[model samples]
Target: MELETIRETYQSGRVVLINKPLQWTSFDVVNKIRWHLTRALQIKKIKVGHAGTLDPLADGLLIVCIGRATKMIEAIQDAPKEYLAAIDLGATTPSYDLETEIEQEYPVEHITEDLVIETLKGFKGEQMQMPPAFSAKKVNGKPAYEYARKNIDVTLKSKKVFFHEIDLQYFEPKHLKVRINCSKGTYIRSFAHDLGQKLNSGAYLQGLTRTAIGQFTLKDAWTLDQYIDKINRLNKYKVGEL
Candidate 1:
């Protein structure tokens, strides 16, 4: 439990893949898992690192590398991801999701299932998008989220992203469920935000769950507690014991 003890026994750069829990920052989970690993093995600290960062508001597969496996993080992030997201119409927000306050609202009387069908077809393509300022993306040497916190306006440049496929599951006038297969940097929040813009109706992400990332998926991910316990259980085994 002491810092020095951890430094002594913990190795650095091991790869772990975990399913992040809702409301816990990636770092919080990392540190908690670190504690679990040390306790299980009766060691100080094991070198552990994580792959892609998932927003606390989102939950899904997060690839982690412990010890030398840490080198694979970038490779993992480069892979595409799939998501099942819900877009709530008739409202708009600064951050595009539940992260910020609702900034505007629109009438939904004119929205229809037919319109939803037509609009979804239009989103299937390569396009340029402005990353949300409330995101972790860096701008001018500082995180855009930091700038947003200080109420400073940040200019974000548009970047190309592809939506390989978007299947409409359910579409009500005010709510829509969609399955999206997109590139690495794609933000479903931004996608929903823009969809509202194109339709001239305000919208925000009501809910989101990452289904797949590259070859990994939620179904294949270890729940947070399960993974932490795994580390504890791992130490009970001997080297070359697998």
Candidate 2:
């Protein structure tokens, strides 16, 4: 499609599926796209927002809404999400993920593959999950992570979340790979922590990737560089041609 056509569509509103890069916040992708769009379309400002917040340490599909499409954010966020997570057993972290150093360790010698599989079955269906301290959840009008980073104690209430499926994809001593299909607001990091507790060992999230959100899949998403390059190519199209 021509630059002019793309610009018009964006102005009218559109949904973009982005494959978020590792260590990049969901907001980072939105900001980058917004920056490029304003410059490429020669506009002072344009509305851009993401449907769900993906942790900076995790990577994968993110749904970004542009212009009038921004109104779709809430609905999209309500959709079910799928994730592939790697849990490192025999250890616990303050942040429940690699964002923090290992705070403690436990023996995983007794944790067999069968035990792991049985434990996973217990996680399926509905349950209340405590949001991690290092999360975007609000606490006294501030983000919970702010207090966590400062080592301040704060109470986070458990919220209801549903897990439709929890499948153990790979298993080895001290490590596990699993696929999860869950409702909105489910936190995989917390799941990792909880799983460890149930198994008489400790665990932390080692890696995570959001593979799908509702009907959207990572396979159809564009990389940030790919989208940016497409926008940069717009400079070659003259206003007179449109």
Candidate 3:
């Protein structure tokens, strides 16, 4: 089903920014787009790829490249990203997200909104951070998650990450809403996780939304349904008109 559609988009090179749905892997969406384009446009084959890999649990802008544009994927992936999230207090997860079970828990008291706001200032600049074990990062030529599945101990070195801004949003004194605009390697999950530790309260990401990636905003992106509709329209109408 996928190969049939890639052939069509191969005829005309174009790029697509898709608003990836939750639980859909980045590769899943990229392959689907490639295949959908080929079948809809009657191309023989299309090389499709995405700018970055968004965790299946996180939903947001995914820059997809078709044909020659695929070569420029890295440029997009290195761009800045923005995310809005809710941090759950009193618990920490191995994955730094709710997808993983609890690794540790802390007492919920002393978690005042003022303390949360003041603590955020410390994360606003550059810092060294270790990626969560249950992540896609490579270790000893293997993905970190692969090693995690085997229950093998893998020590990950901390990387320097730049945080553009970490602002406090609606603070409930328990769960907190915040906006994080940061560099490519900065992980909001780790930020929240570490923030909790610094405050003597464990933390995990309760919610996340990639509001933007570099210049691509959620508004200029397409849903799967909308992409399908556009492709069908192109089939019935002139490509120039589309």
User: Highest TM-score, which number?
Assistant: 2
For 63-174, candidate 1 gives per-residue lDDT tens digits of 7766566677789888888899989999999899998989889988888888877888888889887888889898988889999988999898889998889998998889
Where model 3 places Cα greater than 4 Å from the true spot, the runs are 1-12, 238-242
Top-down lDDT ranking = 2, 3, 1
Clash list (residue pairs), candidate 3: 5-35, 5-38, 5-39, 6-46, 7-43, 7-44, 7-45, 8-38, 8-43
Error (Å) of candidate 2 at residue 240 is 20
For candidate 3, the per-residue lDDT at 118 reads 89
User: For every candidate structure, what is the RMSD over all alpha carbons to the true structure, in angstroms?
Assistant: 3.9, 2.7, 3.4
- Quality of model 2 by C-alpha lDDT: 0.92
After TM-score superposition, the amount by which residue 109's alpha carbon in candidate 1 deviates from its true location, in angstroms, is: 1.8
lDDT of each: 0.79, 0.92, 0.81
- Candidate 2, residues 106-221, lDDT tens digits: the string is 99999999999999999989998999999989999999999999999999999999999999999999889999999999999999999999999999999999999999999999
Worst 10 residues of 1 by lDDT: 1-10
For residue 202, what is the lDDT in candidate 3? Answer: 90
Residues 1-242, candidate 3, lDDT per residue (tens digit)?
24334334454557787899999999999877767776775666668888877888888888888778777888888988888888989988888897788888789888888888888888878899989888878998999999888889898989999889888878775689899888897777888899989889899998888888888887888897788687666645543444
For each candidate in turn, the TM-score is 0.88, 0.94, 0.91
Best by lDDT: 2
Candidate 1 wrong stretches, greater than 4 Å:
1-15, 42-45, 235-242
As for candidate 2, its clashing pairs are: none
